[model samples]
Target chain A: MAALCGHGAPIALLSPAYNEAVTIVQSVRSLLSLQYPAFEVIVINDGSKDATLDTLIEAFELKPVSRAYDLAVPCNEIRGVYASPRLPRLVVIDKVNGGKADALNAGINISRAPVLCSMDADSLLEPDSLLRAVRPFVEDPERVIAVGGTVRLANGCRVRDGRVVEIGLGRHPLALFQTVEYLRAFLMARLAWSRMGALTIISGAFGLFRREAVVRAGGYTRGTVGEDMELVVKLHRQMRREKRDYRIAYVPEPVCWTEAPESWRVLGRQRSRWHRGSLETFFRHWAMFLNPRYGRVGLIGFLNIFIVDVLGPVIEVLGYILIPVLWLLGILSVEYLLAFLALSFTFGITISVCSLALEEIQLRRYPKARDLALLTLAAIFENFGYRQINNLWRIRGLWQYLRGSESWGVMTRKGFRAG
Target chain B: MTGGLLGGLWTASLLMAASSVLFMTGLVIARLISEAGRARRRARREALVADMMSAMDGEADAARLKSEVREPRLVARALLELSTLIRGRELAAVTAALTQAGAEPALLRLMRSRNGEDQIAACEALGLFPSDKAAAALKTRLKRRTSMRVRIAAARALLQMGETPDLNDLLAAFDIGEVHAPLELSAILDEIARRATEAYLERLKSSRDAPALRAMMVGVLGRLGRYEALPVLLGAASDPEPSVRAAALSALGALGHPDAEPIIAAALDDPVPEVRAEACDAAGRTALAALAPRLAERLDDDEWLVRFRAASALLRLGEAGRETLDAAAGRASPRAMRTAQMVLAEAAA
Candidate 1:
């Protein structure tokens, strides 16, 4: 099915970069190696403080090109457009620091393909990723408005020429925990949501969207931290309002590898930012909160967001506090308290392990029993401390949301370990 | 008091926790056992692929190949794996040897499976054995009311077998309707048109009532570089549906026929922004030098894409277009000046 799907539809891959000099070249190289018939890679350097533009120009022999772009979507002023004389498929845009959303908008403006794929500069797609990701669009072109693929951690993988040549579990405990968390998130949660036709979030790490649909939906809301989720929700809202038949799909076969944060501080900041972004999107689209007008997307999709994202954090934090307090105040017995905590932890482990088992059975990307065993261990151990820390970060994000904070905390990157 | 009210909750929590732990442990053990078995099977398959490759290269005899072919499914898997790495005579040798070993019956049986994955795999495997029987089975799959994926796979298999179904049959097999005009579907149409251009063109002519289908067919003709499609495309340039008109203009642009200059010139003033934009693009693609002035006039068009494409079209008109762009860049409307300057800078670079 995948081999028959990718015929000759030109697609544009948009990679929005901000201070990504370390990984941009590798990412572009991997994208250029994709096995699609026709595609162009447009790298938008969002006014990085580092020498990202310089590095790209040096690597690809880029020169300023006189290309006209439309203002179909609003973005910051583009500094210049660059293209490599040797590489016809590579286009570079230099624009002001308008955030990732703005950079993506800038990319959408310059790209001329019928379909547009938005990805991060820090992630590398498999060689056949585009061919696999594009199946839904080919299968049902009229209804499938957007599609997302699974993203896996590349922290401990052996990298050669921007490809994950060997898969291994991350050495850091935090990274290991995230590996299981991502497995659960993408394999269990997203797959189920996609089956229900209520997939509202196509990860910013890698997602494909119909160019016209995205352009009509106002191209990634600029000020939102969760621009990916916001764009999808906006699509659902507009399509539902206009009473259009559409689908947002998720395919698990196509895999994208991204570096996971290894440090506690970085992971915390990332989680909090993600939580804050979800909150901002949910609040902005509060009208669709269980509103039947939006169909399943409103009732099921948004309801999931409200339960898991909005209230789950508060309830979790309350459980952490009240379980102990109630026990200390004699309102709850010791046996009852231990049982309750054990149930929560065990349930968390069960979910994580289930996702791991699903991945092992289906993907087998790990290809090693030791890696699976380590992941299983991480899943069980995470319930002891990592999950609690994550909830605390979510609580922090909630606090920041209440205080009306809009800052996107700086996320540092450690470049992939080269072969 | 504590025993009565909290008793049920405690018991339920403990039971749930224990059950979850046991369930998780059971799943892990099951996966580990499954992985170990899979590993052994993978090793055996690797050895079989080695044997098949050796046999194909004539290092080994057909007796060894026949022994391995006892498991037709495994041999088919090996052939599929080696298909990507080997080609030309090596591929033909493998296919002939596998066909002689009777891998066809197993694959044909697999093709009749209810599972979509098995059907897809069977279709691909049958592509290697492009006999009349294989083609017949593939065509039968195409005619079935199965999933689109299976149908596409079957169609691709037919193409691999060097069989071009009638254009109507192919369209119906694809389940192409008025609303379903995916780009890849157009590509399949383009591929079919490539094999029998005139027949496909005549089929397209009868699709006038299906506007989307007509537009897609017209676009395929343009991509195929069918110079004979000029008159038909010219008629389509005035299609009632804006989408068809846009498609015709784009196809005309792709064809770059000199006779399309007049229509392309008039389309610059099209009421629809998309048509006008395609007109500007067509003007540039054909290098309609005579339409340089008309394309220049569109620099002040209301639509940004139209203005951009017009400026690009002027740039393609050699010296005349460059002078117009230079003039516009120096003194024109703010929108036009910005577009002109950007276009010229790109040209200079």
Candidate 2:
């Protein structure tokens, strides 16, 4: 078990907060309760207009501390460093609003830990998340530079004292649909990719990385909305090019419960931004697409992402519109149209159901049968309307990306339901 | 003709859709049944665990305990739980109970199962039994070209069994060709260093081992900080491979032997920047004041990391090193100045 401690690599959990005053306190509290033996929680207040820094300062009893930190990575100016006298492991950095990547860079510079765990301010990690997620690093200390945990929707879960007290299905249709989607993405796709040693993205919600490797990969690249994916790709390229044995792993057990956008508007914005980020990363690392030099990552992982993820929406959206148009124009026979529709919908439902089955076999987090039934229903119902809307949003994202739109869009959060 | 073609396509797609629907329905039913079964098994296991706990309190006989947990899965689970909860004589007692229950044979059979996941579970279960047979089974699995997951599980099982696996087999299994060996080797060596330092030392001295593996071994030795490894590390400092040489230099630093200062200082002039960079770090660790001047010369080196290391090493040398950095900051190259400033700022913080 001592070896499981990653050679006793100290971890720094960095939460870059931006106007998340409502959720920041709970997230920080959740991070503070992590079961890891050696870790420090550093919250970077990215010049939020809201009282995020004030909330953290008041909650943690933080006092300004003069500390010397290496500027290991380039970042925007950090205004001040604060530490809690009561909790020595808790540190907060007040810095200008330099987006997520810049804030992460600042956190990297301020952190002294050998390992860094980047987290979203609105996400609540399970108590043993760090302990479980760090196993890959411990097991493969030389080659495993990064490990990502599964991110589950917290919309339906009951929260108390910054912890998920009760797990349940949200009555919101959008929330339930997103839960199934998250489960499918994390449990099936990410797991299969990681098993093949071609995991491309460790969700920004919760990911652990070696500080040295991240630093050597030039930290998180600034200005990209997909900084997390960009960083993973950069690490893969750098490590592979240097002929170093490395693994970017995804652990399915350690769950990071994150607040999902309940409203269609917010969800649309989030999906569009995510799609744009994927496209940006895809184009940025175009050299790796089908390039055998990068091995499985370039040959399979990159192509899978490019086709199934990046271009999937465009194809689906076009299918939806073009089929109707073609049928109306007499080019597509009504019988053929009906059959095609049936095939697509049923196949989609089957994949979703299969993902649910995989979830049951592996994690089985949702205890109540009623919740599982609701999720199954949601998986089926999502194909009717929710998925189509999501496809359209992603298509819109593609349009925006082509139009050179770099806007992250305003993400309004209602915070988690506390009990 | 077109009508017939369309009809055929329609019929085909309809069949595909219907089959998918049927497949999903079957999966749903299967999942429900499996979940129900698992729940039933879990309830039984819980009852058995409670009985075993009471038995541990002297309420039940060994024969009764074995009968109470007749199922192989239950026995393995109980043993795993008890192993972690109790230690010393209590653990020995639990192991004895498990053996009497024939847990070893059951687990050995499971370890040889065709299913990879089953093999992993069995390997983990075997870890609860501290027997030579269990260790041998795990070692055999490690040598097999099993999935990476199963191999790692077997290796961990062996570690739990307190067996030091052959380092060469471990390296070969990981395929240390062009890339560095998997980091799991580090964990294995960490465990080995604790249990069998002699065996680890012998492997380190074996020239047939991969350079990356030998270098990693040197790192493990350095982390162990065994003064006895100083001679081996000193010999490794001049290895043909620069990576091994760098590893040796870094290990020497970790060992913190001031007597190795000459060897480390010579590495500062090595053709490889990586080796020289490690030498600078080693100099800092050993507080080689004589090398401080030479380290200062690296402050202007072409390699940025080497320059950074040189500056940091100078900082570690205290007042004399501080003088060298101050001089570099004022009169040396731009990179030297930048490095010195950053280190000084860090030092102040």
Give the count of colliding residue pairs in each prediction: 2, 4
Kindly report the fnat of each predicted structure, to 2 decimals.
0.29, 0.15
Instruction: After the best TM-score superposition of candidate 1, give how far the Cα of residue A189 lies from its true spot, in angstroms.
Output: 2.4
lDDT of 1 at B86: 89
> Candidate 1 falls in which docking quality class?
acceptable
Deviation from native of the Cα of residue B270 in model 2, angstroms = 6.0
Q: Write the per-residue lDDT of candidate 2 for residues A300-333, one digit (tens) a residue.
A: 9899988976879878878888987997888976
Every candidate's DockQ is: 0.28, 0.19
TM-score top scorer = 1
Identify the leading candidate in terms of lDDT: 1
Superposed by TM-score, candidate 1 places the C-alpha of residue A419 at a distance from the truth, in angstroms, of 2.8
Clashing pairs in 1: A65-B346, A66-B346
Q: State the lDDT of candidate 2 residue by residue for B278-322, as single tens digits.
A: 899999999998898999999978766677789889989988999
- TM-score of candidate 1's A chain against the true A chain: 0.97
| Model 2: CAPRI class | incorrect
